[model samples]
Target: MPSFTLPRAARITRITRTHKIAVAVLAAAGATSGLAVTSAPDTAQAASEHAPAAVKPVDAKGQPAKADDAKTGRAVTASVADHVKVDSVAKQHSAKQAASRSAERPAVKDYPLSIMKDKGIPGSYEGLHRNIMRESAGDPNAVNGWDVNAVNGTPSKGLLQVIQPTFDTYHVEGTPNKLTDPIANITAAANYAADRYGSIDNVDSAY
Candidate 1:
C-alpha cells in the first residue's frame, strides 16, 4: 500500500498557472468595460447631430410667429370692412335726405305787368298804376306795419296794401298765389274795386 504526495515544486508550478489564467481573464474584462465607457459620449454626440431640430410655430404667411396671429389679422380685416360699409351707407342716406329737402322748396317765377289784361280781368293800367303808387309807391312787397290790421296781426300786404282776407277772397286765377306778385295784387284789387265801386278807373282815393 503506497500513499505518496505530489512533489512541492510541481504543486507550486500548478498554482502559478492557475493564478496567471485568472489574471488574464480579469484584464480582458477590464479592457471591454473601458471601451464601453469611452465610446458613450461620442455615440450620444452623433445621435444629437443627426436628430431633427425643435419645431417652431408659424403663421399662414410662413413667418416665424404664433400660429394664432393669422386669425387675429383676419378678424381685424373683417372689422375694417364692416366699418367701411356702414360709413358708405350713412353717407348715402345723408345725401338722399339732403336731396329730399331741396326738392320740397318751390321755384319762384317772374310775371309780366300785363297779366291782368291777358287773363280777362276788368282793370285799366292807369287806374291800377295810380292806386299802386298811392298805396305802396309801386312796391310789390310793401306792407302796412303801423295800421289797425298790423296791430291785429293781419298786416296789409302787396302793391295795393290789401289784407290777407281781401286777397284770399278776390284772388285772380292764372297768376301766382303770392301777395307780393305785382300782377296778382293788381288784378285782385281791381276786381274788388269793380265789385264795390263798379270799376277800377272810377276810384282815385284809398278805396
Candidate 2:
C-alpha cells in the first residue's frame, strides 16, 4: 500500500515547531527571566570593580591632597599651576604701575638751593628773621599803626615793615604780594639791607 504525503505549507509548519522546541530547551538551561546570562571566570569575579578614581591635587609645597582637592574631590594640580602664573603676572603689573607713578611724580631735586640763594640777599637773612620775629612774630598779614601813609601811621606789612616804594624795588618775581608775603618781604628786606647798610649788622642802627 502507498503512504499519503503532506503539502509544502504543512511541511514548513512542522519544521518551525521542531526549531521552537530546540530553542526552548537551550533557554531553560542558561536563561534568567528573558535574558541569556553567562557567568564570569573565578579570577575576574574576585577582582575589585569600582568607579574611576580621581587624581589628588597638590599644594604650593608639593604636598598631595590639598583643601581644594578635598572640596572638589578632583585633581587641581593644573588649576594650582595656573593660579601661580596669574599671581606672578599680577605682581609684575603692580610693580610696573608703582614705578610709573614714581616717575610721573615731581622729583625733590627739581627745586635747588642755588635758585633760592640767587634770589636771596646774603648776611641779611639772620637780621630779617630776628626783626620779623620781633615786629609781626612772622605773621603774614600783620598790620601796624592803622592805615596812615607818610607822617607816622604808615602800614607795615608781613614779617618785615616794608613800605610800598621799597616793595616795588626788591619784590621777588612771580609773587602776588611785594610786602604782604613773609618770604618775599624777608627777601626784599634782606636785599635792601645789603644795599643800604652793606650788611645786616648795621641795619639796627639805621632803624
Candidate 3:
C-alpha cells in the first residue's frame, strides 16, 4: 500500500485538540489541590489561605493548652541577676554598719603617764605590774599547766602570759618573736588588751 498522510490543516487541528485535552486534565488535577491556573507562582499562598486550621494540643480536661511565653527564659535570668545584686548590696551594707559600730566605741584611757612613757607603751605600769603579778609573778618563762588554755594545747606563757597565737598576732613590728622575751611578751599583751578593752589599764581581771 502507498504511504498515507493527513493534509497540513488536518494535522494542525489534531495537535490543537490534543493540547486542549492535556490542559483540561491538568486543570482538573489542580482544582482538587487548590492550585491557581492563572497565576502559578501564587498557587501555594492561595492554597495556604484556604487551608483548614491545624489541630491544637489539649489538656486533660479537653481545654486547649496555653503556650509558654517566649519571655519566660529572659524573666528567670533577670530574676537571678537581681537576686545576686541585692545580696551583694546587703552584704556590703552590713560590713559598713559593722565597721561604723567598731569605730564609734571610745578607747579606754586609765593608764599612768609615767609608765606609758617609760615602757614605750600607752598603758599604765601599775596595770601591767598588777596583771603580771597575778598571772606569773613576773616570770618570763611561766607556763600554766591546769588552765583551760593549757587543756586546749595553747597554754599562756611569758611575763604577760600570752598564748602563742595571741603573741604572734600582736607582736610589735620591731620586737623579737620569742614568747619568753620580757619586752616582746609585755608589748604583745598590752597591744591585745588595748584592742579588746581599749587599754591594758582598763583590764583589772584575767583578760
Point to the candidate with the largest TM-score.
1
TM-score, every prediction:
0.43, 0.41, 0.42
Better of 2 and 3 by lDDT: 3
The model with the greater TM-score, 2 or 3, is 3
| Better TM-score candidate (1, 3) | 1
lDDT, each prediction: 0.77, 0.65, 0.77
TM-score of 3: 0.42
The alpha-carbon deviation from the true structure for residue 17 of candidate 3, after best TM-score superposition, in angstroms, is: 99
- Tens-digit lDDT track of model 2 for 1-207: 899899999999999899899898877754764353344435555554443566665665567766767677445656677889999999999999999988886453322122236765555335655666776786778777654543565566766677767888877665456578655666666667768877554566323
Q: What is the lDDT of residue 54 in candidate 1?
A: 78
lDDT of 1 by residue, 6-121 (tens): 89999999999999999999999999999988767787788999999976645434456544544456644555577789999999999999999877753222133355556555
Deviating ranges (above 4 Å) for candidate 2: 1-116, 146-153
Report lDDT (Cα) of residue 117, candidate 3: 52
- Per-residue lDDT, model 3, residue 168, is 87
Q: Let me know the TM-score candidate 1 reaches against the reference structure.
A: 0.43
